[model samples]
Target chain A: MKKYTNTGSKDTRSGFGAGMTELGQKNENVVALCADLIGSLKFDEFKKNHPERFFQVGIAEANMIGIAAGLTIGGKIPFTGTFANFSTGRVYDQIRQSVAYSDKNVKICASHAGLTLGEDGATHQILEDIGLMKMLPGMTVINTCDYNQTKAATLALADHHGPAYLRFGRPVVPNFTPADEPFVIGKAIMLNEGTDVTIIATGHLVWEALLAAEALEAKGISAEVINIHTIKPLDDTAILKSVAKTGCVVTAEEHNFLGGLGESVARVLALNNPKPQEFVAVNDSFGESGTPEQLMEKYKLNNQAIVEAVERVIKRK
Target chain B: MSNTQQLQDFSTQVRRDILRMVHAVNSGHPGGSLGCTEFFTALYQQLLERKPGFNMDGIGEDLFFLSNGHISPVFYSVLARSGYFPVAELATFRKLNSRLQGHPTTHDGLPGVRMASGSLGQGMSVAIGAAQAKKLNGDKHLIYSLHGDGELQEGQNWEAIMYASAKKIDNLIATIDLNGQQIDGSTDDVLNLGNLKTKFEAFDWDVLEIKEGNNIDAIIKGMTEAKSRTGKGKPVCVLLHTVMGNGVDFMMHTHAWHGKAPNNEQLAVGLAQNAETLGDY
Candidate 1:
């Protein structure tokens, strides 16, 4: 539907690992805890360079979350890394009490998020993570689009003093954003200006939103694409302004539509500016073992679906 | 480090604080707190080399985590007497919007509490985590954890025990207050912990037994032995045998006072047994 330049791709997890290494060297108080996914989480650098700051907590996500909370009490900023599923679902209570409700400054670094975890199947691919995290009070939820943005977001959460869930994914995605873009938390990045409809996307869907915008541009429809990396603090002004001018909306994410970015955006728009919105996300269903492309096609989480959602919303408007 | 007399006096003072704090609110777990007073006092006064002012990170100081958070009275008493907070704050315990709640939580920004541990069976995991943090920070300071025998029913403690042994978390030396009484009744009646030493050994932990846990001198010796056994690749799990309601004649030997506060009449009787060495909060 859209023609875009191909860029070199990199796994977002590497962004986390590289960012953590840089942050560890810069701040002595920055500590890391990993629950048996050292290689997967790319925590090898932090562990090697700052051995004292890296905790290889073997298969203890619950304990790791708790210990991370404890480290925060001592004025230490702790980053906990694990798969998205175990990080959120496995230790929800621990995060809810020790981190979120208690308001500890811990970075819940989650890798292998969404269906892109690929072949690890339904169990490892956690689509409900954003929903679970967003429900908790005082929790700042972030879903970075690509490698560069995820890397920047990881470093940014360390400076912010509160409980934060930094969600990233496995598959190597397009590394199009500037290598050193400043990641402003809770602020949406406007990729393109348009007047017909607003395409609000997050995480892997940011690239899709860009693709849909190019297709819509060719079809005489000006689609505004917004990258909503930070889902919790929804950047009300930017979102409302874009929605007010566009008069319709379409949300895209690699997660379930129930409590993911779509619902968050809908809530913000409902309060500020009521507009017709269509969600382009995994329809209330769990993921299965498949290739990233297969999973995307099966879940209807591709650029074509996003463009269609935008067209439907535009027609309704 | 405190000598024998200092340990005794600190133990008495902690017991006094526990009684008064619980009596003030007419709500708290006094039985186990009373039972573990000497053990906790001995550990704080003689065992731990702490800084004068309390810091949350405890970078240089040894860390202690209470898994059984219901026994907040004993923990609050020891913390206050040990100069973790102003002794006067003991009266504010469980009061309206006080740092000292019914459970140990960092929510109030309390200096000593590192995590919220009202949910049982999570403290050991948290302790092991803190111990792991110490290792990660290259800080060789030891960590201490106390748990009630009956509270072991929460399977997470055993999971942590298994993990510590497997990971060789040798820097952590934990003590289990084997008072053998829960709110329901004896540990045997509630859920048989089924041979704790055997369990710890099976879990590959360096296990030790303290027959006279409530005795301050014995507590000092046992903890010394526990500390000596560390630095190897196995985490130390010391089984401390203590009475449910120790120190006070009437409260001892039963689970009735496990969570019940001492009424005014019983409060006087309990206070008579423990003199306020550092003055009442």
Candidate 2:
């Protein structure tokens, strides 16, 4: 097994801010719009650097979405920033009619995703965003795991045409991915290779999967860990190849199991390779106010949960 | 022929196209289409300074967006007649594999359509955004959009309405088709949009009214004045008060033909009412 080190701990939202700051200098056509959450979304540096390019849309997300779609008409790549809930559910029809259906180049950057959003409670934390975005035709859905990856994905989306949804969290996590690595929209990263079980994870759950692999290695069991950053146009080849070697799979994500990364992986497995699978995700329910650690522990989304799921799936295989 | 007479002839021909397109499909909104024929005709034929061909990135030229896209018959007619596409293609309106979908969309690579609208209250924001883009590009061309008065009930319209004035998007001229009727009933019965001039003025927009909305001459005069109001630190709004159906006497003064296609007898009546001066497609 290969070892990876955490360079440091940083919140993914700040990484988005970092990426926007770089893009402000690099691409003149890259414009940013925020709905009165400039500080929460960490868009201060980008706003300060490119005061002309940054648009403060004041609390109107629907209008923000419409304006972003229109901005694409005159060769401007508009990046809209808001919470995950406001980004997806609040303005779905606007996205459907303007951006996706019209096939405009707009990047919808969402922060404070999933249960890791912590004390803001169920209203702010959105878990169904991936599903809503993926269902739209011609929409690229990317959920970055760490700070470095989030920054890379933000830069990558500028070159990508059409509509996309880039999801990240508010909680700070280990920045494991390399800073200079080029971000691919649909490619999956192989974190660790093993034979006993395959553990596929996305978003914040990716680091947890790595920790679970280390724990399983200590117990004389080999576990393969794959990081699926892009949920839609999923890295199906990587998933199928790893599951072929392990014969059993465990899918993890910080989302509802009903319509999330786990279900997407399960569909792939069910279609081609029939294998025993376990899901490490939020069952059909809403999240409440709690610390990020407490929510992960209570919702069974940590490394311990993956370790137990691996043990159960291995036995079934 | 003089310019006003030619535009009136053009509008009469366009009114014929609206009736024929809807009558052929047996589905579509013809009331607003007939109602807005003069406005569309005057904008495309006289008011707008447009390029010869259509492109998505309409730089260095004026751009127009149809917010209440249910009136696509009139929009398609004006776009085709103005040489964006072949006027014969208007026969394929709402048919399968047709570039002309029920709602205007750029998805089919249709020229002259920058945004998909049938879902109301979205085009104003799109127009404002395009206007801002023009400002960013140093392109002084204007962005024009038309919406239904009933579409004002949507919350998103209010948001965009508030935003345009606040941002000082002076390069946009948004016109509201005050036909005073919607699908369910009259605008007054469904929802009273009280005092539109005051509402827009309070929102800090430059407001004007074309009382003779169905008249080609009045529409030209009003829109030309609306153009002069640009670059003055406020977005302009034109409240165009028109009848639901203008030329066809049977269809006028009511919301009956809002989305309903006319029968053969009524189609004959409508066609006879607006004598085709420019020939039918």
Candidate 3:
């Protein structure tokens, strides 16, 4: 197995802020809008650098979405920042009518996703945002794994035209990806190569899949790990090739199994190559207030859960 | 550059177009469309500072968004007659494979429409956004929008209303079609929008009213005054008090025609009341 090391620990939101700050200097038409969560979304530096391009839209997410859609009419690229729940559900119609149906180039950047939002509880922690965003036609959905990947995705989105949703988390995690890797929208990253089972993961679970692969290797079981950053316009080619070699698969994400990466992988396999697959995700349930570490452990979303899922799928194969 | 008689002739033709299009489809909102005929005619024909042809990014020109998009008949007629698209395409209103959807949208590459609106209370925010962009681009042209009085019940309008004033978006003119009727009943019975002039004033907007909203000259004068109030540090609001079905006598003083198309006999009456001056599509 190739060795991967964490260069540092950093929050994904900070990566977005760093990318925005860079974009403020690089792209003149890039504008940022926040709905009373500028500090939470870590957009202070961009606002400070480009006060003329920044808009503070108070607590109205709907108005922020409409404004973002409108800003696109005159060749301005608008980025809207808010929590994952408010970003997807609170302003769904506004996004649907003004952005998605109208074909506006607006980037909806959401932080504090899933149970990893910690003590803010179920209200702030949204596990269904990926499903909601992916359902909209022409909406590109991206969920980054770490700080490095998140920053790279943010920069890539500036050049990407059309409505898109970029989901990230609040808690700090391992920044394992290289600093200078060019982020591709729909390409999956190959983390490891093995013959036993294929492990497909997204968001924070990508790091966990790497750890699980190591644990499985120690048990004399070989595993292949893949990181899926973009859920919509999924990288089916990579998944099919890896699954064809391994003969079975386990999909992991910090979202409900019914609508997350697991279901998408299931459809791809069921149609072309049916394989025994297991899911390591939330079982259609809401999250509660707890530390992100405790929540990950209790929800069975850590490395141990992935290892178990891999073992179960390998047995079926 | 059109004189009063020319604008009146244009409005009569637009009203005729609205009645015929709705009658042919047997479904569409003609009540508010009839009421706002003069306003649409005045704005498109004589008021807006526009350039020939169409593009999505309408830089260096005025932009208009229809918030209460159910009244698409008047919007479509005015847009077509004003040369945004061919007037003959008005026959395709609300049919299968038509660019003119039931609600106004830019989805089908329709010219003259900047955003999708049928869902009410969203146009103000969009207009405010376009106004802000114009400011950012150093473009001096203004952004204009129209809404229904019933649309104010939607909470998002208040959010945009507060935002426009707080941001001092002075280059926008949002006019409300105060027809005093919705799907259910009169605005008084449905939900009393008490003292709209004061309500807008409290929101820190410069409010004006065109009491004779059905009159072409009155609409032009009032909207021109509203335009003069622009760039003075606050957004301007024009309250247009129009009868629900203004031109046709039988359809007036009630909400019956809000979304219902006139039958053959009623259509004949409506067509006769507003004689075609520029011919039909």
Native-interface RMSD of candidate 3: 0.6
After superposition, candidate 1 runs with Cα above 4 Å error = A1-5, A21-31, A44-54, A70-77, A101-104, B1-10, B23-26, B135-140, B262-278
**lDDT (CA) per prediction:** 0.86, 0.94, 0.94
State which docking tier applies to candidate 1: acceptable
lDDT of 1 by residue, B1-281 (tens): 66788788888888888888888898998899988989888877788877777667788878888878898988888887777888888889999999999998887788777667777777787777678767767788899988888878876676678778887889888789898888888888988889999989999999999999888888888899999999989999999999888888998989999989888998898888887776777
- Candidate 2 — what's its lDDT? 0.94
Predicted candidate 2 versus true structure: per-residue lDDT over A200-257, tens digit per residue? 9999999999999999999999999999999988999999999988999999999988
lDDT of 1: 0.86
**Residue A115, model 3: Cα distance from true site in angstroms:** 0.6
Docking verdict class for candidate 3: high
DockQ of each: 0.39, 0.88, 0.84
Candidate 1 displacement at residue A105 in angstroms: 4.0
Ranking by DockQ: 2, 3, 1
Model 3 per-residue lDDT tens digits across residues B29-115: 999999999999999998999989997889999999899999999999999999999999999999999998989998899999999
Q: Count the backbone clashes (under 3 Å) in each candidate.
A: 2, 0, 0
Q: Regarding lDDT, does 1 or 2 come out ahead?
A: 2
Q: Compared with the true structure, what per-residue lDDT tens digits does model 3 show for residues A1-317?
A: 87899999999999999999999999999999999999999999999999999999999999999999989989999999999999998999999999999999999999999999999899988888888888899999999999999999999999999999999989999999999999999999999999999999999999999999999999999999999999988999999999999999999999988788899899999998999999999999999999999999999999999999988988898
